[model samples]
Target: MSKRIAGPEIERLIQLLAKVPGLGPRSARRAALQLIKKKEQLLSPLAAAMAEAVDAVRICSNCGNVDTCDPCTVCTDPRRDGATIIVVEDVADLWALERAGAMNARYHVLGGTLSPLDGIGPDELNIKALIDRVAGGGVSELILAVNATVEGQTTAHYITDQLSGLEVRVTRLAHGVPVGGELDYLDEGTLSAALKSRTAF
Candidate 1:
Protein backbone atom coordinates (compact mmCIF):
# COMPACT_ATOMS: atom_id res chain seq x y z
CA MET A 1 0.00 0.00 0.00
CA SER A 2 1.08 3.60 -0.65
CA LYS A 3 2.25 5.62 2.36
CA ARG A 4 -0.26 8.12 3.77
CA ILE A 5 1.08 11.56 2.77
CA ALA A 6 -1.97 13.63 3.71
CA GLY A 7 -5.01 13.59 6.05
CA PRO A 8 -8.01 11.37 5.20
CA GLU A 9 -10.12 14.40 4.18
CA ILE A 10 -7.50 15.68 1.73
CA GLU A 11 -6.95 12.18 0.34
CA ARG A 12 -10.70 11.79 -0.17
CA LEU A 13 -10.83 15.12 -1.96
CA ILE A 14 -8.10 13.99 -4.35
CA GLN A 15 -9.90 10.65 -4.93
CA LEU A 16 -13.17 12.38 -5.85
CA LEU A 17 -11.44 14.97 -8.01
CA ALA A 18 -9.71 12.16 -9.91
CA LYS A 19 -13.13 10.87 -11.00
CA VAL A 20 -13.69 14.07 -13.03
CA PRO A 21 -13.03 14.01 -16.76
CA GLY A 22 -9.43 14.74 -17.93
CA LEU A 23 -8.22 14.59 -14.30
CA GLY A 24 -5.85 11.78 -13.32
CA PRO A 25 -4.76 10.88 -9.78
CA ARG A 26 -1.68 13.12 -9.98
CA SER A 27 -3.63 16.03 -11.47
CA ALA A 28 -6.37 15.61 -8.87
CA ARG A 29 -3.76 15.76 -6.10
CA ARG A 30 -2.42 19.05 -7.55
CA ALA A 31 -5.94 20.45 -7.92
CA ALA A 32 -6.86 19.45 -4.35
CA LEU A 33 -3.73 21.19 -3.06
CA GLN A 34 -4.61 24.32 -5.05
CA LEU A 35 -8.19 24.28 -3.82
CA ILE A 36 -7.07 23.89 -0.21
CA LYS A 37 -4.54 26.70 -0.62
CA LYS A 38 -7.23 29.08 -1.96
CA LYS A 39 -9.96 27.85 0.39
CA GLU A 40 -11.38 31.32 0.97
CA GLN A 41 -11.33 32.60 -2.62
CA LEU A 42 -11.69 29.78 -5.20
CA LEU A 43 -12.87 26.86 -3.06
CA SER A 44 -15.62 28.71 -1.24
CA PRO A 45 -17.08 30.21 -4.42
CA LEU A 46 -16.80 26.94 -6.31
CA ALA A 47 -18.55 25.06 -3.50
CA ALA A 48 -21.37 27.58 -3.44
CA ALA A 49 -21.72 27.49 -7.22
CA MET A 50 -21.87 23.69 -7.17
CA ALA A 51 -24.51 23.77 -4.45
CA GLU A 52 -26.59 26.26 -6.47
CA ALA A 53 -26.21 24.12 -9.61
CA VAL A 54 -27.41 21.01 -7.80
CA ASP A 55 -30.58 22.84 -6.77
CA ALA A 56 -31.23 24.70 -10.03
CA VAL A 57 -30.05 22.34 -12.77
CA ARG A 58 -32.83 20.56 -14.63
CA ILE A 59 -33.27 18.38 -17.70
CA CYS A 60 -35.41 20.11 -20.31
CA SER A 61 -38.54 18.09 -21.08
CA ASN A 62 -38.81 19.27 -24.68
CA CYS A 63 -35.36 18.98 -26.33
CA GLY A 64 -33.41 17.05 -23.65
CA ASN A 65 -31.16 20.05 -23.01
CA VAL A 66 -30.06 20.68 -19.44
CA ASP A 67 -31.15 24.01 -17.98
CA THR A 68 -32.66 25.52 -14.87
CA CYS A 69 -36.07 25.46 -16.64
CA ASP A 70 -38.34 22.72 -17.93
CA PRO A 71 -38.52 23.58 -21.64
CA CYS A 72 -35.13 25.33 -21.60
CA THR A 73 -34.44 28.80 -22.99
CA VAL A 74 -33.89 27.45 -26.52
CA CYS A 75 -37.28 25.81 -26.68
CA THR A 76 -39.09 28.96 -25.45
CA ASP A 77 -37.04 31.40 -27.51
CA PRO A 78 -39.35 33.12 -29.99
CA ARG A 79 -36.39 34.68 -31.82
CA ARG A 80 -34.96 31.33 -32.90
CA ASP A 81 -36.26 29.54 -35.99
CA GLY A 82 -38.27 26.54 -34.89
CA ALA A 83 -38.40 25.37 -38.51
CA THR A 84 -34.68 24.48 -38.44
CA ILE A 85 -33.42 21.99 -35.84
CA ILE A 86 -29.86 20.81 -35.32
CA VAL A 87 -29.83 17.29 -33.89
CA VAL A 88 -26.74 16.54 -31.82
CA GLU A 89 -25.53 13.45 -29.96
CA ASP A 90 -25.40 15.18 -26.57
CA VAL A 91 -25.72 18.46 -24.65
CA ALA A 92 -22.00 19.11 -25.11
CA ASP A 93 -22.43 19.19 -28.88
CA LEU A 94 -25.44 21.47 -28.50
CA TRP A 95 -23.39 23.88 -26.36
CA ALA A 96 -20.51 23.82 -28.87
CA LEU A 97 -22.86 24.64 -31.75
CA GLU A 98 -24.50 27.39 -29.73
CA ARG A 99 -21.05 28.86 -29.06
CA ALA A 100 -20.39 28.91 -32.82
CA GLY A 101 -23.75 30.71 -33.43
CA ALA A 102 -23.76 29.30 -36.94
CA MET A 103 -27.53 29.79 -37.32
CA ASN A 104 -30.40 31.23 -35.37
CA ALA A 105 -32.09 27.85 -35.17
CA ARG A 106 -33.33 25.42 -32.53
CA TYR A 107 -31.66 22.22 -31.28
CA HIS A 108 -32.38 18.61 -30.25
CA VAL A 109 -30.18 16.43 -28.04
CA LEU A 110 -30.24 12.66 -28.64
CA GLY A 111 -28.63 11.99 -25.24
CA GLY A 112 -26.25 9.61 -26.98
CA THR A 113 -25.62 7.77 -30.25
CA LEU A 114 -26.56 4.19 -31.16
CA SER A 115 -23.93 1.88 -29.72
CA PRO A 116 -25.32 -1.68 -29.88
CA LEU A 117 -21.99 -3.05 -28.75
CA ASP A 118 -22.22 -0.93 -25.64
CA GLY A 119 -25.90 -2.02 -25.22
CA ILE A 120 -27.22 1.48 -26.07
CA GLY A 121 -30.04 1.37 -28.63
CA PRO A 122 -32.88 3.50 -30.01
CA ASP A 123 -34.90 3.34 -26.82
CA GLU A 124 -31.85 4.23 -24.72
CA LEU A 125 -31.55 7.64 -26.37
CA ASN A 126 -34.09 10.49 -26.69
CA ILE A 127 -34.94 9.54 -30.30
CA LYS A 128 -38.69 9.01 -29.84
CA ALA A 129 -39.02 12.58 -28.55
CA LEU A 130 -37.24 13.89 -31.65
CA ILE A 131 -39.58 11.94 -33.96
CA ASP A 132 -42.56 13.23 -32.05
CA ARG A 133 -41.34 16.82 -32.44
CA VAL A 134 -40.93 16.40 -36.20
CA ALA A 135 -44.30 14.72 -36.54
CA GLY A 136 -45.92 17.55 -34.62
CA GLY A 137 -45.00 19.88 -37.56
CA GLY A 138 -43.33 23.31 -38.16
CA VAL A 139 -39.89 21.67 -38.47
CA SER A 140 -38.54 22.13 -42.04
CA GLU A 141 -34.86 21.14 -41.85
CA LEU A 142 -32.89 18.73 -39.62
CA ILE A 143 -29.13 19.09 -39.47
CA LEU A 144 -27.48 15.99 -37.98
CA ALA A 145 -24.51 17.51 -36.20
CA VAL A 146 -23.34 14.20 -34.73
CA ASN A 147 -19.68 13.26 -34.54
CA ALA A 148 -17.81 11.42 -37.37
CA THR A 149 -17.82 8.15 -35.43
CA VAL A 150 -19.36 4.86 -36.57
CA GLU A 151 -21.88 4.95 -33.75
CA GLY A 152 -22.76 8.58 -34.54
CA GLN A 153 -23.30 7.75 -38.24
CA THR A 154 -25.41 4.76 -37.30
CA THR A 155 -27.56 6.91 -35.06
CA ALA A 156 -27.98 9.51 -37.84
CA HIS A 157 -29.02 6.81 -40.31
CA TYR A 158 -31.51 5.41 -37.81
CA ILE A 159 -32.98 8.86 -37.22
CA THR A 160 -33.24 9.47 -40.97
CA ASP A 161 -35.00 6.16 -41.48
CA GLN A 162 -37.45 7.01 -38.75
CA LEU A 163 -38.27 10.31 -40.50
CA SER A 164 -38.48 8.83 -44.00
CA GLY A 165 -42.13 9.79 -44.57
CA LEU A 166 -41.76 13.11 -42.81
CA GLU A 167 -41.55 16.48 -44.63
CA VAL A 168 -38.27 17.58 -43.02
CA ARG A 169 -35.06 17.95 -45.05
CA VAL A 170 -32.22 15.93 -43.45
CA THR A 171 -28.59 17.05 -43.83
CA ARG A 172 -25.24 16.05 -42.30
CA LEU A 173 -22.24 18.12 -41.28
CA ALA A 174 -19.74 18.55 -44.12
CA HIS A 175 -16.50 16.71 -43.37
CA GLY A 176 -13.34 18.45 -44.55
CA VAL A 177 -10.04 19.95 -43.56
CA PRO A 178 -10.47 22.39 -40.72
CA VAL A 179 -9.79 26.11 -41.19
CA GLY A 180 -5.97 26.81 -41.21
CA GLY A 181 -5.21 23.05 -41.30
CA GLU A 182 -2.48 21.90 -43.71
CA LEU A 183 -3.39 19.15 -46.20
CA ASP A 184 -0.25 17.18 -45.31
CA TYR A 185 -1.61 16.39 -41.82
CA LEU A 186 -5.13 15.48 -43.03
CA ASP A 187 -6.29 11.90 -43.56
CA GLU A 188 -7.48 10.42 -46.86
CA GLY A 189 -11.16 10.45 -45.81
CA THR A 190 -11.08 14.16 -44.91
CA LEU A 191 -9.19 15.00 -48.12
CA SER A 192 -11.68 13.08 -50.22
CA ALA A 193 -14.67 14.64 -48.51
CA ALA A 194 -13.19 18.13 -48.85
CA LEU A 195 -12.62 17.55 -52.57
CA LYS A 196 -16.10 16.14 -53.13
CA SER A 197 -17.73 18.94 -51.16
CA ARG A 198 -15.66 21.71 -52.79
CA THR A 199 -17.70 24.88 -52.80
CA ALA A 200 -17.40 28.20 -54.65
CA PHE A 201 -14.19 29.85 -53.48
Candidate 2:
Protein backbone atom coordinates (compact mmCIF):
# COMPACT_ATOMS: atom_id res chain seq x y z
CA MET A 1 0.00 0.00 0.00
CA SER A 2 1.23 3.52 -0.73
CA LYS A 3 1.88 5.74 2.29
CA ARG A 4 -1.49 6.65 3.85
CA ILE A 5 -1.21 10.43 4.08
CA ALA A 6 -4.87 10.92 4.97
CA GLY A 7 -4.80 8.68 8.06
CA PRO A 8 -7.21 5.73 8.38
CA GLU A 9 -10.34 7.81 9.12
CA ILE A 10 -9.96 10.37 6.33
CA GLU A 11 -8.77 7.66 3.94
CA ARG A 12 -11.90 5.70 4.76
CA LEU A 13 -14.01 8.77 3.98
CA ILE A 14 -12.21 9.23 0.67
CA GLN A 15 -12.74 5.56 -0.22
CA LEU A 16 -16.44 5.81 0.58
CA LEU A 17 -16.78 9.03 -1.42
CA ALA A 18 -15.02 7.42 -4.36
CA LYS A 19 -17.62 4.67 -4.40
CA VAL A 20 -20.32 7.16 -5.46
CA PRO A 21 -21.17 7.28 -9.15
CA GLY A 22 -19.17 9.77 -11.30
CA LEU A 23 -16.50 9.95 -8.58
CA GLY A 24 -13.08 8.33 -8.64
CA PRO A 25 -10.06 8.21 -6.34
CA ARG A 26 -8.58 11.44 -7.70
CA SER A 27 -11.88 13.33 -7.50
CA ALA A 28 -12.51 11.92 -4.06
CA ARG A 29 -9.04 13.06 -2.94
CA ARG A 30 -9.69 16.55 -4.30
CA ALA A 31 -13.11 16.59 -2.61
CA ALA A 32 -11.61 15.43 0.67
CA LEU A 33 -8.96 18.13 0.49
CA GLN A 34 -11.60 20.77 -0.23
CA LEU A 35 -13.74 19.53 2.62
CA ILE A 36 -10.80 19.53 5.00
CA LYS A 37 -9.93 23.05 3.92
CA LYS A 38 -13.47 24.16 4.73
CA LYS A 39 -14.23 21.71 7.51
CA GLU A 40 -16.59 23.93 9.46
CA GLN A 41 -18.46 25.30 6.43
CA LEU A 42 -18.67 22.27 4.20
CA LEU A 43 -17.58 18.97 5.78
CA SER A 44 -19.56 19.23 9.00
CA PRO A 45 -22.78 20.25 7.31
CA LEU A 46 -22.35 17.65 4.58
CA ALA A 47 -21.81 14.93 7.18
CA ALA A 48 -24.83 16.09 9.12
CA ALA A 49 -26.98 16.21 6.00
CA MET A 50 -25.89 12.73 4.98
CA ALA A 51 -26.65 11.40 8.44
CA GLU A 52 -30.07 13.03 8.47
CA ALA A 53 -30.88 11.71 4.99
CA VAL A 54 -29.72 8.20 5.90
CA ASP A 55 -31.90 8.27 8.99
CA ALA A 56 -35.03 9.81 7.46
CA VAL A 57 -35.16 8.80 3.80
CA ARG A 58 -36.92 5.53 3.08
CA ILE A 59 -38.75 3.75 0.32
CA CYS A 60 -42.32 4.92 -0.10
CA SER A 61 -44.65 2.12 0.95
CA ASN A 62 -47.04 2.60 -1.99
CA CYS A 63 -44.61 3.41 -4.85
CA GLY A 64 -41.05 2.46 -3.87
CA ASN A 65 -39.99 6.13 -4.08
CA VAL A 66 -37.35 7.31 -1.66
CA ASP A 67 -38.84 10.03 0.50
CA THR A 68 -38.69 11.39 3.98
CA CYS A 69 -42.22 10.16 4.50
CA ASP A 70 -44.16 7.09 3.50
CA PRO A 71 -46.40 7.17 0.38
CA CYS A 72 -44.22 10.03 -0.98
CA THR A 73 -45.45 13.43 -2.12
CA VAL A 74 -46.57 12.26 -5.54
CA CYS A 75 -48.49 9.23 -4.28
CA THR A 76 -50.24 11.33 -1.68
CA ASP A 77 -50.98 14.27 -3.93
CA PRO A 78 -54.68 14.80 -4.49
CA ARG A 79 -54.13 16.85 -7.66
CA ARG A 80 -52.27 14.11 -9.51
CA ASP A 81 -54.19 11.85 -11.87
CA GLY A 82 -54.65 8.67 -9.91
CA ALA A 83 -56.17 6.95 -12.96
CA THR A 84 -52.76 6.81 -14.66
CA ILE A 85 -49.46 5.56 -13.28
CA ILE A 86 -46.11 5.50 -15.03
CA VAL A 87 -43.87 2.58 -14.20
CA VAL A 88 -40.17 3.31 -14.15
CA GLU A 89 -37.04 1.49 -12.99
CA ASP A 90 -35.66 3.96 -10.48
CA VAL A 91 -36.16 7.31 -8.71
CA ALA A 92 -33.90 8.93 -11.28
CA ASP A 93 -36.30 7.86 -14.01
CA LEU A 94 -39.19 9.29 -12.04
CA TRP A 95 -37.30 12.56 -11.62
CA ALA A 96 -36.67 12.67 -15.34
CA LEU A 97 -40.37 12.22 -16.03
CA GLU A 98 -41.21 14.94 -13.57
CA ARG A 99 -38.63 17.24 -15.10
CA ALA A 100 -40.30 16.79 -18.48
CA GLY A 101 -43.54 18.01 -16.85
CA ALA A 102 -45.57 16.04 -19.36
CA MET A 103 -46.66 13.24 -17.08
CA ASN A 104 -49.35 14.20 -14.65
CA ALA A 105 -49.81 10.63 -13.51
CA ARG A 106 -48.27 9.18 -10.40
CA TYR A 107 -45.29 6.85 -10.66
CA HIS A 108 -44.31 3.38 -9.48
CA VAL A 109 -40.59 2.77 -9.28
CA LEU A 110 -39.75 -0.86 -10.11
CA GLY A 111 -36.38 -0.51 -8.32
CA GLY A 112 -34.76 -2.51 -11.15
CA THR A 113 -35.42 -4.40 -14.35
CA LEU A 114 -35.49 -8.15 -15.05
CA SER A 115 -32.05 -9.60 -15.67
CA PRO A 116 -31.87 -13.39 -15.66
CA LEU A 117 -28.13 -13.59 -16.22
CA ASP A 118 -27.54 -11.19 -13.35
CA GLY A 119 -29.92 -13.35 -11.27
CA ILE A 120 -32.25 -10.37 -10.82
CA GLY A 121 -35.79 -11.67 -11.22
CA PRO A 122 -39.21 -10.03 -11.06
CA ASP A 123 -39.54 -10.98 -7.42
CA GLU A 124 -36.38 -9.02 -6.55
CA LEU A 125 -37.93 -5.82 -7.90
CA ASN A 126 -41.08 -3.97 -6.73
CA ILE A 127 -43.35 -5.87 -9.13
CA LYS A 128 -45.56 -7.13 -6.34
CA ALA A 129 -46.21 -3.61 -5.16
CA LEU A 130 -47.16 -2.55 -8.69
CA ILE A 131 -49.58 -5.44 -8.91
CA ASP A 132 -51.11 -4.40 -5.64
CA ARG A 133 -51.45 -0.82 -6.86
CA VAL A 134 -53.20 -1.98 -10.01
CA ALA A 135 -55.43 -4.31 -8.08
CA GLY A 136 -56.61 -1.49 -5.88
CA GLY A 137 -58.53 -0.35 -9.01
CA GLY A 138 -58.35 3.40 -9.58
CA VAL A 139 -55.58 3.19 -12.19
CA SER A 140 -56.95 3.22 -15.74
CA GLU A 141 -53.62 3.24 -17.57
CA LEU A 142 -50.09 2.00 -16.91
CA ILE A 143 -47.36 3.59 -19.00
CA LEU A 144 -44.25 1.47 -19.08
CA ALA A 145 -41.50 4.09 -19.15
CA VAL A 146 -38.73 1.64 -18.45
CA ASN A 147 -35.42 2.01 -20.34
CA ALA A 148 -35.17 0.62 -23.87
CA THR A 149 -32.50 -1.92 -22.99
CA VAL A 150 -33.09 -5.67 -23.37
CA GLU A 151 -33.65 -6.07 -19.66
CA GLY A 152 -35.99 -3.10 -19.67
CA GLN A 153 -38.09 -4.58 -22.47
CA THR A 154 -38.14 -7.90 -20.65
CA THR A 155 -39.33 -6.21 -17.49
CA ALA A 156 -42.00 -4.29 -19.39
CA HIS A 157 -43.25 -7.48 -20.99
CA TYR A 158 -43.27 -9.13 -17.60
CA ILE A 159 -45.37 -6.30 -16.21
CA THR A 160 -47.72 -6.55 -19.18
CA ASP A 161 -48.09 -10.27 -18.54
CA GLN A 162 -48.90 -9.57 -14.91
CA LEU A 163 -51.55 -7.00 -15.84
CA SER A 164 -53.04 -9.02 -18.68
CA GLY A 165 -56.24 -9.95 -16.94
CA LEU A 166 -56.78 -6.50 -15.48
CA GLU A 167 -59.07 -3.88 -17.04
CA VAL A 168 -56.39 -1.17 -17.03
CA ARG A 169 -54.84 -0.16 -20.36
CA VAL A 170 -51.10 -0.85 -20.63
CA THR A 171 -48.90 1.27 -22.89
CA ARG A 172 -45.19 1.74 -23.53
CA LEU A 173 -42.94 4.66 -24.29
CA ALA A 174 -42.81 5.44 -28.01
CA HIS A 175 -40.04 4.04 -30.22
CA GLY A 176 -38.22 7.37 -30.35
CA VAL A 177 -36.31 6.47 -27.23
CA PRO A 178 -32.93 5.17 -28.26
CA VAL A 179 -32.11 1.58 -27.37
CA GLY A 180 -29.89 1.25 -24.29
CA GLY A 181 -30.49 4.91 -23.40
CA GLU A 182 -31.67 5.75 -19.93
CA LEU A 183 -34.54 8.21 -19.47
CA ASP A 184 -32.39 10.28 -17.13
CA TYR A 185 -30.07 11.16 -20.00
CA LEU A 186 -32.80 12.19 -22.42
CA ASP A 187 -33.74 15.82 -22.95
CA GLU A 188 -37.07 17.20 -21.72
CA GLY A 189 -38.56 17.65 -25.20
CA THR A 190 -37.68 14.13 -26.26
CA LEU A 191 -39.09 12.72 -23.07
CA SER A 192 -42.26 14.77 -23.51
CA ALA A 193 -42.68 13.53 -27.08
CA ALA A 194 -42.13 9.95 -25.97
CA LEU A 195 -44.81 10.31 -23.33
CA LYS A 196 -47.23 11.94 -25.74
CA SER A 197 -46.79 9.31 -28.43
CA ARG A 198 -46.68 6.23 -26.20
CA THR A 199 -48.25 3.20 -27.85
CA ALA A 200 -49.63 -0.10 -26.71
CA PHE A 201 -46.85 -2.63 -26.16
Model 2, span 1-201: residue lDDT tens:
377665788889888989989989899988988998999999999999999999999789999998999989999999999999999999999999999899789999999999989899988999998998999998999999999788998999999999888889999877657768899999887788778878899
Local distance difference test scores for all models: 0.94, 0.91
Q: Which stretches of candidate 1 lie over 4 Å from their true place?
A: none
Looking at model 1, the pairs that clash are none
Q: Which stretches of candidate 2 lie over 4 Å from their true place?
A: 177-201
Q: Per-prediction count of colliding residue pairs?
A: 0, 0
lDDT by residue (tens digit), candidate 1, 18-96: 9999999989989999999999999889989999999999999999999999989999999999999999998999999
| Model 1 RMSD vs true structure | 1.3
**Top candidate by TM-score:** 1
